[model samples]
Target: MSTITHRLPQKRHLVTELPGPKSVALAERRQAAVPAGLGSGVPVYAVDGDGGVLVDVDGNSLIDLGSGIAVTTVGASNAAVADAVAAQAHHLIHTCFLVTPYEGYVAVAEKLNELTPGDHEKRTALFNSGAEAVENAVKVARVATGRDAVVAFDHAYHGRTNLTMALTAKSVPYKHNFGPFAPEVYRMPMSYPYRDPLGDDGVAAARRAITAIGTQIGADGVAAVIVEPIQGEGGFVVPAPGFLPTLAQWCRANGIVFVADEVQSGFCRTGDWFACEHEGVVPDIVTTAKGIAGGMPLAGVTGRAELMDAVHPGGLGGTYSGNPVACAAALAAIDQMETLDLCARARAIGEIATSSLTATAALLAADGREVIGDIRGRGGMIAVELVRPGTSEPAPDLAKAVAAGALARGLVILTCGTYGNVIRLLPPLVIDDALLREGLAILGEVLAESA
Candidate 1:
């Protein structure tokens, strides 16, 4: 079971100094070809990836703990997904779902509607990216409710589009000089236990966000309340227990369409098929992407039938939305997930991560190094929040150094959060146990050395 299918060895091997001569030359080419705004986390260029390792251009096999920012949850080269993609590509790639609707797109929508929370009659619209899904979700909400105001929580990351930028709270990187963003998007206090004064009391924190919504945005005017089931990019912040439920209930009572942005925390990345299930919150609209199509560019907006049907006949859809090839890949990915029981695998991975990180933090503390401010998340999506030693102050610099150190050791890790102080572990669910631990050990050593 520990030996996940892959052509390359599952061990971390560094043959060259990070960006070897070949990678250095490619970097020079990339600097000239690619825009500076687009950044890469790992220094080396990837040639192939499967199972738990990424083979770089310089013959270095780096352990991939980021899963390409949580997109390749089924691994980079699942045989089934590849075969499906190839079969579909051989037949028909795209005919424009709108012009000549295909069964693949309809089949994917049917699957999404069936899988998302709640057994009630649901519908789904496919799109190209998470931002596009989010934007359309809001569009559906506003059209159905006839309201313009929308409420988003703090530390929320819907996407990078103009509307999503307004929905986001962080500024420097995501929102810097990108205004004037879409108007009528209100930010509410999220149930952030680590940073909130309320501590672990999720009920009270929900109350705070609800009150702010009523006073600041006028709940009556709100078309939707969009939030990440487990905030990704915004530090992997999991709202305290009872927090999401309270907000969902409030939205229900106020006639607001509760939109759960599960773009990053969906598709078994958080143990459950969807992170909102952790809190038993059935959102009115669920935005999905990232791990949806086995790295294929596909997004979905699943919601109540009435809300989705409210839009005009041609209101939703794009030229490449739900491309046949992507749908085929999604189908095979779903088959692999169900047959392999990836949800259970994710839970097992979560267990290992929580135990290892907690033990490592305790050991570090015993040595008088207390940089780990918090450790949180479920399933394979774990986060280690770094803080100043002996204090709760955020330490972004320390987080950067730790990630860089791990990269030097041939482990590809990712750091995220509004303050950029959280190291998030998003290994593919198919990662072998030994490889996952080896990656964890490298991260632990890097953090310890950073102290």
Candidate 2:
């Protein structure tokens, strides 16, 4: 049996400055070859990653707090993940599960069905990315309900694809100039407690949203009401405790499918197998992606069997839908999550990190400069919204400065929100407590300086 250890790998030497000579050289090459706007958020070059540390090509050993946008839940360059991928590659790379079904693919689906919330007989379909999973869920809902209208929430982010762009709420980068998008897609107000019309009353806000759906769109014409259980890109916004359950009840009563977009908040990222699980709400359809395959490109949509089977025999599949390598990696990732008790770790990390951020933000606020407006999220998926004093306005400049400051201190932090004023932390669930504390200390220092 392989021994399981909780210690993170030691950080090596940081010879040159951040994005040192080697990374600078690679960035230059990438700028010439890659598209102009392709690589902006993260540094261009990576030399190695193991456990919680990312070793850049410049030889800078930085604590990986971003986790590749929350995809590497089990940790970057995990031994089990590497071994599984290598062994599967040796055996068979791509058999195209659609053409010739493979055990690895079927096993992955079974695991997803078993793991995802909802005890009712569930069926799962695998896809290549979170975007594909969402697209498939939309397709299944449209076909199953025989309705054309799909309703998404404001400030929601589904994906970058054409159909998903219509579902997504952001327009500047995701939807700007990419329009002539899919039709019959509508947007509705989400129960944003921080900025809710009902003053943080989640239940009342949900009822208001439901009422709008009934009056404006007519629930009969709506195929599905899709939402992220805990908004990922909309700044780790966790809806009121009773908000999602109320919506799910409404969807069931009206026969409109409820799809939970768990792409960024699923697979133990939010302390449970799915964020929806926190509310005891079982969606008709759940889309999962990030953190599903230990960084491999794999996604899945699990839903009621009847809804999933609504598509005709040949309606739901892709050429590389369930690639064997990704399947094997997913199976191994699931094992790692279960064996390592990552869900509990996610909760623990969230408690520690969020508490630290909240305390630091309060201190800054007491100093007459409001540093954080809201600190909200469930489990490990947490965010701190930065704002100016005496108003709810976004502090984008401060957020940028804090992120850059953290990066300079050898820590990788990611910022997100509709206004880009929220500093989000998505460190791997397996991050050691010591490293986590160190990262939080760096963030506190940045906050103090920015204030």
Kindly list the per-residue Cα lDDT of model 1 for residues 1-451, writing each as its tens digit: 2334676678888899987889999999999999999988777899989888898888999999999999999999888899999999999988998999899999999999988999989999999999999999999999999999999988988889999999999997898998999999999888888999998899999999888877887888999999998999999998889898998999999899999999999998898899999878899999999999899999999999999999998999999999999999999988778877888999999999999999889999999999999999999999999999999899999999998999999999999999999999999999999999999988888888997
Q: Which numbered prediction scores highest in lDDT against the true structure? A: 1
Residue-level lDDT for 269 in candidate 1: 88
Clashing pairs in 2: none
What lDDT is reached at residue 263 by model 1?
Answer: 95
Off by over 4 Å in 1: 1-4
Give the Cα-based TM-score of candidate 2 against the true structure.
0.97
Clashes of each: 0, 0
